[model samples]
Target: MKRVVFAVPGSLDTPTGGYAYDRRIVAELRQLGWDVECLNVGEGFPSPDKATQSAARSLLLKVPDGQPIVVDGLALGVLPDVAGEVASRHPLLGLVHHPLALEWGLSAERADALHRSEQAALALAREVVVTSPATAKLVASDYGVPAERITVARPGSDPAPRSSGSRNEVPHLLSVGAVVPRKGFEVLVAALATLVELPWRLTIVGDLTRDPNEAARLQASISQHKLTGRIAALGAVPSKRLAGLYDEADLFVLASHFEGYGMAYAEALSHGLPVIGTTAGAIPDTVPQEAGLLVAPGDAGELAGALRRVIADAELRRRLSDAASAAARTLPTWQQSAAIFATALEKLA
Candidate 1:
């Protein structure tokens, strides 16, 4: 039997995009009869430190000597030397959720270092899998990876039922993601401030991370904008409950600074909610124009206007709702993503 190892940062319980991708892919591969193993390299394994490098090297040694290994980009990009060490002995693949170089909040010097590291890591992979065409292009242009060697596999959403309630009430807008700078919660708050008199309520569903400074900054901004009454931040709800939230919401909004695949946007559409997102990263590809609106990132006025238009015009909302539902049906499931990934591995085997 052929074995495949998926190396990633943190455990399956980690609430980040990379962990979600790893969990889904591993489950799918097992169903397809591939011998799959998952190794958690803990948090911050990719830092530029001797201890982190040693830990990464140790992780490379644990993979079965001859098995093809799929290293998560979070772990792989930080430790390019480890990829160099393993590629010679194993058919190595790199699964990138998004390039580290394009991550939000990085300084120019840090971003350049991440870019160089990712470029070196790509050289060591026999194949690379990315979640969107936008990311695939970034991998090619920035990391120097050939376009042919990269595979675009989108993430999937579980089926969600449409909310059953009276439609005559005021519209409720939903935004789901971590309370980090990259997720652009501040942008959403700023947009909400402009439409204070509108009869709409905004619910933010995401957990605040361990970073106190970010949490404090966002809280201060919320107060400064006087959005306390209109906006509510409900940190991390269970998956089962999220469906209900989606059902009740008239629209879904994601003002991310950047995203590799924007899974939440897809999830919202699956629940038949129209979307509003920034034209950053892969959001434009994920959201069909007919299903929702896309605006420039950090443009509070544009986001505010879009929100107002959708709220005031019932016909426009109905049209977008129908279109979003149709688009959601066309998305692949985790099983399909696994099948595509398995086919890629079979060729290399």
Candidate 2:
């Protein structure tokens, strides 16, 4: 039987985009009859200390010989020394959702350190699997990975019911992502503050606990903007509950600093909710122009203008919604993504 070890940084249940991608891909691969073993090499990844790094390396070293080992980017990028060792023993495939150094809120020195380490780690891999073409390009051009060695298997979006829209007299805006600096929820809050006179409410759904300080900071920002009364913050929610939120939203927006594939934008399109997001990373690749409006990252005034236009013009909303439904039909399914991923894995044989 064909089998591979998928070594992830932490629990498979982490409710972020990267983990969600890992979970779905693993399930699809198993459904396709691959013997996929998920090895949790311990936590505190993308920033593991000496003891944790030693322990993680030990766990990875214990994988049986001859099995292809697929390591999540979060763990793989920070473990160059271990990756070199792993490459000596097994076929090492690095799965990168995005390069770690580009993440928001990192200091210049820290980002540079992560960049150097990730480039070194990726160099030793037999294959690199990225979730988007943008990442594939970045890895090849910036990380020095050969273009031929990379595969782009973007996250799959499940078909969802078109949003029935808000029951309220005001439009309901929805944004989904962890309450981290990268998601730019603070930017969203600042943008929304200028549109209060325009009848609209924003609901943000993401993991608040992932970064408590960032979450608390967002709360303070919301309070500062006097938008606590207009905005709803729901920490991590179950998939079903999220689906329900999608069903009720009039528009979807996320002012993310960067994204590998912007799964939330893909999901919003799938729900036939017109999108408003920043033009950072792979967002433009994810949200079709006809289906959404995009603004410069961190530009609150630009974002506010886009939001106001979308909120005030019902005809524009209808047009974008129709286009969004069209775009949704073009999204790949988990089954198709799994098939592609399987083919990528087969090439390693």
* Model 2 Cα lDDT, one tens digit per residue, 1-349: 7899999999999999999999999999999999999999888989888988999989888988878999999999999999999999999999999999999999999999999999999999999999988899899999999998999999998978899999677999999999999999989999899888999988999999988999999999999999988998999999889999999999999999999999999999988999999999999888889999999999999999999999998889989999999999998999999898888888777
Worst 10 residues of 1 by lDDT: 161-170
What is the lDDT of every predicted structure here? 0.83, 0.93
Which 10 residues in a row give candidate 2 its minimum summed lDDT? 340-349
lDDT score of residue 149 within candidate 2: 90
Badly placed stretches (over 4 Å) of model 2 are none
User: Model 1: residues >4 Å from true position, as ranges?
Assistant: 45-49, 165-168
- Overall local distance difference test of candidate 1: 0.83
- Per-residue C-alpha lDDT of model 1 across residues 131-233, encoded as one tens digit per residue: 9999999999888898878888889777777644236577888988878788888888888888877788888888776345777777888889987777787
169: Cα error in model 1, Å: 2.8
Error of 2 at 209 (Å): 0.8
